[model samples]
Target: MSSVKERFLRYVQVETTSCEANECCPSTPGQKVLGEMLVKEMQAMGVSGARMDEHGYVYGFIPAKGKTDAPAIGLIAHMDTSDAVPGKTVPQVIEHYDGGVIRLKNGVEISGFSFLESLKGQDLIVTSGDSVLGADDKAGVAEIMTLCEKMLAPDAPDHGKICVAFTPDEEIGRGADLFDIPGFGAEFAYTVDGGALGELEYECFNAASCKVTVKGVNIHPGSAKNQMINASLVAMEFAGMLPPWERPEHTEGYEGFYHLMEMSGNEEAAELKYILRDHDIRKLDARKQMMNTACEVLNKKYGDGTVLVELRDSYRNMKEIVEQHPEILERAKAAFLANGVEPIVKAIRGGTDGAQLSFRGLPCPNLSTGGYNFHGRKELVPVQAMEKMTEVLVTLVSVK
Candidate 1:
């Protein structure tokens, strides 16, 4: 059996950082590389239908060894890391953490006082201080891979048909765009992309991305009193009109907010990009309407058509879908208990591939990858947590 640490270290070294601006499916060639690698690895594990599709999605099936009548369960994980940072990672292993601050060579510190207290006494795998650790879903990938290898053994317990998919561009929120759901033939699926151990999530925020463009007329300073309209200032005004306390930095646990992701402008024109999120659908709609109202008020003050706001729905909460099939959560909880880990059921403040997959009729839920502080230089994951997650996967599949 391949250790999860070895598998994760090897996979994260592949550098599969997805691109949000890319028009293609996988978003990066590195995704294709990882997909092809997964295909080969799956085929070696005796999984049938192991193929990397034209769009760089790696999928395969492990036939039922004993009971062929059981419902087929899907195990999924993404191949790409977040585009927030580079993914050319060199993982650092800290064996037996002594409950103090861990200083990364890149001049960052993971202080024991700041959430690191929970991970004390565990072996951690972190980045080399320059890039993300890629454990966001790569840890998921390694866990799924290890579980498949175990199930393929001759003495393994009986299981239903198990389907596995390694999707690309999840970091860019396009993980499910090219997913072959019907072809996958699984009644339900689980995405191994959550943080920490024993995290089983079905609720996620209703997400939307907005682009606000402000147009202004520039004039010479001598005649700038009433003739000039500064676009940057107007953009700032529009942002300030939103509730100041409602933001990612100030809110937590079901408190939705409008996050201004990027803002750039000059006197002529300025653009502000934002991501709006709320777990409650009603509040989500209200948040969008708030954006419209802000635009309306700004336009009223500076003539019509001065502000243009574009809103696009990204994903929705999966709670309604997963609640209908309570057995999935129950089975996961049982599996976690059997593995000596208490399940932490919570609502994800952000989105996951499972959220999109659930709406696509797969009824998928998110599972933990034991990773912490993802998408930056401080990303880390516990080796023991990864091993237990793999065990949880095996237990879930083995259960009738």
Candidate 2:
């Protein structure tokens, strides 16, 4: 069986960054490339049904052994990495970390992370400052593949029906849009796409996307007094109306925030893109109302039709759906304890594929891949944590 570290190091070399501008299913060609490779690996491990669909989703199955009557369980992970940084990487392995500042190739330093001190004396996998480490989901992919490879061994532990899937474009929030839930053939599933070891999450933020457009009349400056209306200035005013303290950088835990993702404009027209998130549906609605109020204020100042806003919901909190079935959480916690790891249940500040999957009748929760500082150049994952998580997965499916 392949170690999780070996698999992760090999998989991160593939460029699978997802693009938000593209409306395609996979959103990028590299996702398909990774999916094809995963399917081939599954087939080589005796998974006869391994295949990649047209949408770049890879699926396979492991029939129940020693106990055929158990319910089918699904394991899921996305194949795409975040577009926050470049996807191509040069991996650096540090053997026996000394718990100090880790300087990468391009003068990027990894420090000040609260979890770094706890990871001392363990081997870590990092990358050069040129790109992200891709541990956000690829580490999850590697761990799942390692688990599947182990389950197929001759001395493998007893298990029920296991369904495995790898999705694409999760970074852009479309990972579960084209998912075939019925065809996935799982009573319930778990998305192995979280951070830190021993993390088990079932709740996530209710999410929405907001777009603000400012339309301005531009006149010749030579004869302009009150005739010119600068759209960029109006856009800045609209942004200043919102509470600056309520943002991603200032909030933590269950505190909700409105994140300004992108803004571009000139004198004639301007556009601002934002993502709204709150664990409470009512709070999310309030955030929407706040956006409307800002638009109304701007339009009142610059005449009618000057400011336009578009607010659309992306996903809801999964806590409402996951709490309906307690057995799912129990099984995961039991498996963690069985592997000598205490389970840490917390709410996810951002949404996951499982958030949408749970609302779609799958009751899926999120699991960790022993990674830290995701979606940036300083991202890293411990070798021992990955190995321990693979063992936990083994016990999770083994018949008790």
Candidate 3:
């Protein structure tokens, strides 16, 4: 069997970065490139139904080797990387890390004082400084591939029928938009797409996206101070009116946050984009209402039509769905412990494809990929942790 590291390295070179502005199902052609590769790989491994659909989803079935009574479980991962950066990754390996600082060729550094400090004694795979490592979900794809290959081996333990899917556009939050849950025929599913070694998450933020547009009267600078109304300054004021402590940089754990994702302005107009998140449905609704109130206050100050706020719900927390199928979580926890790793059950600060899938009638939970600092230049993954994660997947499918 090919090692997880080798599989991951091969997957990341495919350049499957998702495009948020695209209207297509997969959202980018690169996703199809990876999907085709996955279909070929799955077929080579003896998966009978390995095929890629027109929408770029690759699905296959691995029949049970010895058992016929166990429930069919689905293993899923996204093929696309985040559009936050480029993903034509050139990965480098650090053998037997001494644990100080790793300097990239492009002047970026992963310092020991950073989260990478804990990975001191392990082998690490990182980017070459100009691109993202694509470990966010590619590591997930590798884990699933490794597990499927192991299941086909003669020495492998018995397992129920397993369904596998490689989805696209997860980074842009449309991973499950076209998912065929009923056709996939799984009692439950797990997305191997979380961070760190033993992370297993079922709860994700109830999410929304807001856009605030400000219209201002642009006057000549020579006209005088009283005639000038700078729209950019008003946009900054709108941002400042929110509670400072509610921002992402200040919160952790169960604390929800309002994140300002983008801002652009001119003398005549300005637009500010924000993403709001909370695990509690009540708090999530309140946050949207708060944005409306803030817009009202600004409108009152700048005139009725000067400020407009548009808020749209993206995805809700998946806990409500997962709670009904508690056995899924229990089995995953047991699998982790069986592999000699402690299960770290926590709430996801951000949304995953599992969040949407759970709402779509699949009790999907997020599993760890053993990657850290994702979607940036300093992204890294521990070799040992990734191998352990692959083992956890195999164990989850094989052990009763």
Score each candidate by Cα lDDT: 0.91, 0.92, 0.90
**TM-score of decoy 3:** 0.96
Candidate 1, 1-400: lDDT as tens digits: 6788899999999989988888998889998988888888888889889998899989998888787788899999999998787789998999999888898877888874466787779999988789999998899999999989999999888999999999998877789998999988899999999997889999999999999999999998788998899999999999999998998999999999999988999999999999999999999999999999999999999999899999999999999899999999998899999989999999999999888989889999999989888888888999989998988899899945
Q: Point out where model 1 deviates above 4 Å.
A: 112-114
Worst 10 residues of 1 by lDDT: 111-120
Better of 1 and 2 by lDDT: 2
Question: Once model 3 is optimally superposed onto the true structure by TM-score, how far is the C-alpha of residue 69 displaced, in angstroms?
Answer: 1.2
**Model 2 whole-model lDDT (C-alpha atoms):** 0.92
Off by over 4 Å in 3: 113-117, 224-228
All-Cα superposition RMSD per candidate: 1.2, 0.9, 1.5
Candidate 2 backbone collisions, by pair: none
lDDT of 2 by residue, 177-264 (tens): 9998888899999999988999999999999999999999988888668998889999999999999999989999999999999999
lDDT (Cα, 0-100) at 233 in candidate 3: 86
- The alpha-carbon lDDT assigned to residue 214 of candidate 3 equals 91
Model 3, span 121-214: residue lDDT tens = 8999998899999998999999999888988888999999899998999888888999888778788999999999889999999999999999
In order of lDDT, best first, we have 2, 1, 3
